[model samples]
Target: MKATTVLAVVCVAACLSIHASALSPFGVGRSQLHKKRWWSSVDVNDLHKYHLDDDPQGYFGYLTQPMDHFDPLINKHFNQRYWVVDKYWKSKSHPVFLYEGEEAELELGEVAYGHHAEMAQAHGALILGLEHRFYGNSTTKEGLLLSELQYLSSQQQLADLAVFRVFAEKKLGMSGTNTWIVIGGSYAGALSAWFRLKYPHLVYGSVASSAPVRAQANFEGYNEVVAASFADPIVFGSEKCVASIRQGFSKIEQMKQAGQLAQIVKDFNTCQDMTDPNDFKTFASDLQGTFMSAAQYNYIEGNSSSIGTLCQQMMVPDPYQALVKMFNPGSTCSDVSFKDFLKLLTDVTFDPGAMSRQWFYQTCTQFGYYQTCDKNTTCMFLPEVDLDYYFAWCKGGYNIPSSDVLEQVNFTNAYYGADNPRGTRVIFVDGTIDPWHALSVLKDLPEGLKSVFMKGTSHCADMAPNDPDAPPALKAGRLEIEKIVSGWLMQAEMEKKHK
Candidate 1:
């Protein structure tokens, strides 16, 4: 079971609708912040506008899934939504590409367009998108109650996929014939690789793009990568850009310590005054997030901002003011209230469409991907936004202790083998500039595994549609993926014939 790893760059061009006074410290709704691609502007009700044709062959549907896949006594079930596109299917014997959904609602646009859809068309395969449990319309009737959310774990989600495979096999008339190739980006990408590792008999291969396979309580490597990206030559980043950012953050910290809160608030256009230490930390987190977002999606097609653009802004005479302007555009008042953020996250009231709370819960219970600044000295963010600052959210939101969060993180890494994942026929793809890549499997393994690391690319850039202006490295990475997938399918066909 040899696998190949690919490091490729991809960009997401989703719009940002951040408010300074939002409940989350990220200065935006947590639901929108965590996804691999942000669909902030795409209304779920009006997704038909993105369809290639009126009533395209791809249709949306739902599957009745158990709320507790491991607990037989629960006997509870929920309808998990999915989208299917069989327009390009050569026959039942052809391959099936399943796009594993992530933290947000599964959009039809995902199944209708993107690299996976293009691959489906090229390979004459069936395409399916399965929304993760507790997201979108895939929720238990009781909603996001703390007790109910206990059922929402990666292990449970993996079981859901296994169950879906069984149902699809019988209903789609492809039992034990068609090969299943799972595909996903970010967290879902981790799932795709884990699925092949856990249930290799079910899925022949997987494409895990920009997947952070490791779970760390304090992800200091994230900011380190961002800082390094600030000096990347491909994006016109220079040492001067990195130095300017560091100096700007140092000035802001000094201002906060010197009791210049009023001046800082006015300069940054914050919605509220920074009276509390928590408030200052929230403000710093917001600034750090702006940089993270830019670096993560730098040069990505359809992106609102890029590293080159950010560097230009940071290199100005007034770096501190330039950083503030980038974060609070149009002189909008940014929210810097940690109390309000805690209140929002602690609210268990379930909105079927909501994502932040659910994602926060997962971070506390399963994967502790807290991008803390205190761990790395080269980090551009203020150290005030440390691990404890994030731990407060988990403790207040779900009463989950920091110790428990660390334990869960350890369990996740141990269970999945972290970056040394034990899987075959899995293509692990990551971009050099993507902070998440630090947690992914970057080195080639001895088990015939391959890793493709694309230089000067953004997060999940290879997952985007084929673009004429895409970097040469990204283009080469995509071709490598296609070739690998083709090889897998061909090998599977040969094995079937021999059997």
Candidate 2:
């Protein structure tokens, strides 16, 4: 084996060998983590305790460490563990940790710990993190599965939360009911709703900020939205309909049909000082995955300074060559035939109108479109690659069908029935200017849910008002969310108990 391959194996072995007893199948605790207490002001940072049963003194040393076979240049690794105080004076309430979303470990929760955990602590609650099952320091088999180990059909990762609750309750010394609150943004918001649905008894309620629960809806619609939202209006100059972007895309499609798409990509990429070149290149590039191309394009369009990097990734130096290697290690670029290449490009296209047609006729009966394509009345869709489901499980293709992109549009319409009485509460928060939120198809949320609109911003919404740099309204909003969440949890609990 090559050095990199051998090193990856070693790391995988080390991870697999790490001692983790199945004290609780899902990390549930046998006892509560903290004593009952009513305090005026709770210090989130000052709080530190976990209910791991083996450690008698209850001190859990924690740190972030690198995990197996990571390329030092591209990947980061770290682990976070918690140590808790003994069970003395502890209340009956057991604390449950809520893990943040998408390729993050549990520590990201600490990033938003200003008042979340503190408030729970004041209520005699033990707040533990719901770690991502195959991410960060948590691993299963060579990080290969890191891309697609597990997820809910709703794209909900609630099962991980349930398992974590069991872990904390039994192994971590947590007690009473698993009354944990689910919290997060964007993808995490979707998770919050999933948790409440999967284990109503365990999770009191969810504080989903920008939840996208309608799984596999308009995966492309979200990409288009985010791209449009971040693209420099100065470059486009005016908001003409989606047609403005479509006009730009039309040129590439024509070129693609003429067997000149590659040259078109080359010309735009090679231009010395191309105006709005990244957007043009994104439209032209034959990216194998969905969402990734748009995401890269959006980044470049938004951060003008990053244009050079975007150029390099798409064309100039062709950064995608390296990624292609990761996807099909040791395979030559030319090995991909023209037909295969075209199929890849076609699938990656993010045309909403086209996808809606396909879902209704081509795919399965998940999202309401149940008719089969045949004979005269066959569902007519533009001939394009179905990248959403194509490279979904491939290596390094996680973002191709990012949970947000999938759950927000076509998936929502198909799989996530809008009027289902699941009592699913969803909070779709987005900046008024955030293009991604605009294209969201997260429908069927419970009437009780609240979707917040953060004015004039992109994807960054967590650290509002108190950033020492945040707006006043943001500060107030941050603190007020607790009460909103508390009420939701109480209502959910009441429904379950009295049902």
Candidate 3:
């Protein structure tokens, strides 16, 4: 492996690993949409939020991709969808910035990040956001089953990006002349950095915000970070909240251990009672999964809003009171029971799993980044999950064998330089507040390549529009990134002239 890759791995020796929904990451829902129903039953409308089509002349298009990118000679094609906007620019002479999409579906989220649109306008650049294959409207001819999902992989998606770049240039009659910069956060951020490295000729630079470049096979640190986020009295609002949560966690553990099934059922509000240890473990994982999901995307500040309406519910001084608030924010009239909570969750969530199967499949096959808890650890969670359970989920959910997942992750780490990514003109950004930030690149890279640490931010905090309340660190980081990208544009032009 490369020296950089080795150093990165050693630093973590271990460690672990989405965004744009408000308080959530993918989309926004109106208070009216839920209709006082518990757990917002996620539907196609909930799949993505529709942005106003008032500016930038955004439109959608499709590209034909091979069924199997690795063996393209014999495979057929599928129409993969993408969207682009080019209205706000100095001129066609500016660099083109590609906002890489994430695992979720998207028409696109609001791209009002601090000065990103301004930078594009100032530089006369074009901006295009490509939906990842198997997401949004992108799909294969055979449709979305494991049989057809075999065509899905980052390698395949990256190739689609390369082809899209070529197609885009030809479509705009600006072939080979425009400098290209790629930007994205979360999984999309990972793609942005990876794309530049793999297709250096096609990309001039990249801004990989909150990217977990390394593929962690055993991602135990995920929940630990979540615990740290809540347990910190300084960052989170109340120590009482933290203490109460801890108490509740202990309560649950004791209940599970002593086979206090009645209390366990009453506490979480499960749809069915689980007596079997294996069944109980699944139940435990689901309950904790809500909390884990919240921390991963807790861009709002304190509280686990992503888990439900957690932070909003956290207004109460007591944790159990807050838990009631979390599980039932709309129903101010009365407390919601745990069983009712299950039914509400089934009806309302866009995906009860908290993620699309496409992403889960990718995680199982390529990433292995589920937030499993550690045994004998006090991370405000139970050790109900590990590689065994995760692999079992993969097998059960996607019908994929777990034989090569770890091997594939190892290969990915080696190939991508793990933390030590090999590239120039790439800026890696991670926030202090985000749990995944630990897996992201924070150290300086060689020369034009660098890292930006956004202090007191969460998830794709940088991806959000200019928030006055945003930390000074985030603002300063944006300025530095802007300078770097501007310099890259100039550099690419100079290199072109020399050539």
RMSD of each: 5.9, 15.1, 8.4
**Per-residue alpha-carbon lDDT of candidate 1 for residues 9-51, written as tens digits (9 for 90 to 100):** 1111121112111212122343343443433334566444433
Number of backbone-clashing residue pairs for each candidate, in the order shown = 19, 56, 19
| Cα error, candidate 2, residue 217 (Å) | 5.6
Kindly indicate the candidate among 2 and 3 with the higher lDDT: 3
**How high is the CA lDDT of each candidate model?**
0.74, 0.35, 0.59
Residue 438 of candidate 3: its Cα lDDT? 66
Give the TM-score of each candidate.
0.90, 0.49, 0.80
The window of 10 residues in a row where model 2 has the poorest summed lDDT is 3-12
Model 2 TM-score on a 0 to 1 scale? 0.49
Model 2: residues >4 Å from true position, as ranges?
A: 1-97, 104-125, 142-157, 172-178, 227-262, 268-421, 424-428, 433-447, 463-465, 471-480, 486-499
lDDT of 3 by residue, 45-69 (tens): 4322312223446777787877676
Candidate 2 lDDT over residue span 1-499, tens digit each? 0101100000000110011111000010011101011111223443342211222233443434334222356354434343343333246544443534332333332332434544454454554454443433444333332232222122323544554456556675555544566665444455566566556777665665434444333334433443444343422222332233334444445655677746643443422221332222222222222122222222212334122232233332333343333233443222212223223323423221111111111112122111111212211111132343222312123333344443344555444343242644444444433323433323334555555554443332432212444444345555556566667656746755886
For model 3, the local distance difference test gives 0.59
Q: Sorted on TM-score, highest at the top, how do the candidates line up? A: 1, 3, 2
